[model samples]
Every structure is written in C-alpha cells, then in structure tokens.
Target: MSNLTTLLALADSRLPTGGHVHSGGIEEAVTSGLVVDLASLRAFLVRRIRTTGLVCASLAVAVHRGALSASAGESGDLETDARTPSPAARQASRAQGRGLVRLGRRIWSDEDWDALGPTPHLAVAAGVVGRAGRLADQHTALSVVYTTMTGSATAAQRLLALDPGDVAALTFDLSALCEQTAAEAAKDVTDLSDPLLDVLAQRHVERDRPLFAS
Candidate 1:
C-alpha cells in the first residue's frame, strides 16, 4: 500500500529484467493459431489468469501463511503435481520465478533475504516478499496477476500489430478478472486448482521451440 514504488518496480516490464521475453505459452499458442485476434487474445489472457495466475496467487497466500512450506523438494513436487497437465506452463512459471527472485534479492533483500529463496515458483516467492512487506493478500495477489498480464501482453504487442489502446483497455478490464481470480484463489479450499491450465502447461512443454519459453 505505502511502497508503491517497490510494487511498480517489481511489476514494471521496462525494468531491464527479461519479463518481456517469455509469453507464458502465448507465443506458442499464437504460432499454433490458438490465439489470433484481440478477442482471442483477451480471452486467452483471462482464462490464463483465472487458471494459472489464480493458482499462483493462491500458492502465494499458502506460502505466506506457512500452510504450505516451499522447500525445494516440497515446492517442486507440488508444482510438478499441479503441472502434470502442462509441463511447459509449469516451466514458464518457474522461469518467471527465477527471474523474479533474482530481481528480488537486488531490490528487496536486506535482513530478510533468508526467506527469498526456497520458492521455485514465482507467485509463491512473490507472496512471501509481499507479505513480508506487510501487503494485503488480495493486493499481493493483484500485483502478481497484473504483472503476469502485463508481461504476456507486452509479449503479444511485440509479436503482433494490435491497437495499443485496445491492449491498455484490455489490461484495465482484465484487472477485474484478476480481482475475481485472486479472490477465488484466496478461498480455503482448492481456490487455485484449475484443470485446463494444467493441461495447457504440460502440452506446452511437449512442443519444440516455436515461440515463447513457457
């Protein structure tokens, strides 16, 4: 809430970091004709947010609460199980995690750097730090969700000729979806569980390099 600068820096696409590189399988989807237009792109992003992003946000809360300890073995195993449906998406999630953690140590680490590692998944790692920053769970969830959408959209714009205004409005409109997804993810049950995303992620890994790392 108070440290908007920190949040923005973490979420910004222009941070010299490589957030713009990976498309979370959007590139592959687009290349494979799974996503072709503004409407399709918007729908893809929403569904991704609701499924993958939702699970990530939920994992963040779970990690923050100590309800789900993210030791390398535990986190990896959990992510693996969650990712059995889509290995590529899972790889993308971890790629973002590595990128975010590397950035986190540079920007956020001080005395609390100890809690920075361990998490192999980006969302859980981000939640740990966000919670440490005293950020609300919902706010933390939104930050992660928006960051992901921004990254994917940035990737899309670079690869296509869509209207920037349309993308901007889409991002704004999708914020509502982020809220709903985050809210659902915060629930006590399997708030983050999504079948379609899991499958897509696994399928993403099966394909060779077309576009998008994840």
Candidate 2:
C-alpha cells in the first residue's frame, strides 16, 4: 500500500481499534445538557482539542520519536493517568490501548508491544504503531488529535440525531485546527487539564445506562 493509504488506514474508524465504544466524553456532555446544539458542540470540541487533544498529540509524537517507550519504562502512561483525573477516562484509554496493541501485533508482526505494558494509553499505542509503520510524527499526532475530534462528533450525531452532513462538515472545518495543534504539540507535549471533561467522565461512568464508556 502507498504511504498515504497506510496512514489513512491507521486513522480509519473501520480499522477495528475499538474507538467506536468511546465518545471522548461527548455522550456525557450531551446528557448533562452541556452540549445541545451545533454551537455548543463546537465550543465543547474546541475546549477538548485545546486540552485533551493537545496532550494526546504530544504523547503520540513522543512515542513515535522514541522519547517515551514501553520498553524504556518511560511510556508516559503515568503522565496520561495523572493528566486524566477521571478513572473512567483512564479505563477507556487503556481499553483502546489494548485494542491497538492487538491490532498492531497482527499488522506489524515484529513490534514488541508487550514492552508498553499490559495497558498503555491510546495515544502511546498510536505512536508505537505509527513509528513501526514508518509514519511521520506530525501525521501521527494529527491522527490522534483528529480522532479525538471526530469520535465525539460522531457520538453527538448518534445521540442527538443531528444532521450527519452538518456534523461531518464541522469535522472538516476543524481539520486545520487539528493540524496546527498536532504540529505545536509535536514540538512539545504541553501538560494540560480539563476539569469539566473529567467531571463529565466520572458522571458518565456512574450513570445506570451510559451509552459510551467515557
């Protein structure tokens, strides 16, 4: 496959990485009435991208660059755990991380995923897999950030019955921002926090019938 196709496939929602089960807190945001319309959704997306998205991008770049590694024991998993104040968010991340490792082992055969430990962060998995595939660090970061934005938007679509076209268009419009954020984050993974998202994640996990894991 072509280099572009390879990257695209890695970022594809159909890749079976278990991304569909988590909404990046969108379901909880909607249930709490914090995101009701396109305007509010966009606002929430912006906040998320600036905070959680940036951190994920940084982690992806670090793993891809080998600055952090499962084998080296500097996986940055603890940092992600610390940044993610919510236990539910951490669990969701590890679940996705495990899924990525499973898929990566099948695709790349030689990579030592076990070094990353029993459960690395999702962005860390992306970095490891992306590096093994010889993908660019910026692109790896972009993929991570893009998923953060798109996953929530797709969840909102399902929960609110919003216009799919409009939701997709919104994602398209945010592409440039995602790119910029990824670029900056690749330069340095800034430590940031989003208390509201943490609160929502905690609340979502406590729900009797939560739609998304976090």
Q: Per-model C-alpha lDDT, please?
A: 0.67, 0.85
The segments of candidate 1 whose C-alpha lies over 4 angstroms from its true place after superposition are 75-84, 111-119, 189-211
Q: Clashing pairs in model 1?
A: 85-198, 86-201, 86-202, 87-201, 87-202, 89-201
TM-scores for all candidates?
A: 0.82, 0.96
- Write down the worst ten-residue block by lDDT for model 2: 69-78
Task: State the lDDT at 144 in candidate 1.
Answer: 72
Best candidate per TM-score, number? 2
Error of 1 at 24 (Å): 1.2
Residues 87-169, model 1: lDDT tens digits: 55555666666676676677656625444454366765666667666676766776777776777787777678788888888
What's the CA RMSD of model 2 in angstroms? 1.3
Poorest 10 consecutive residues by lDDT, candidate 1? 111-120
Residue 44's C-alpha lDDT in candidate 2? 89
Model 2 TM-score (2 dp): 0.96
Cα RMSD for candidates in order: 2.9, 1.3
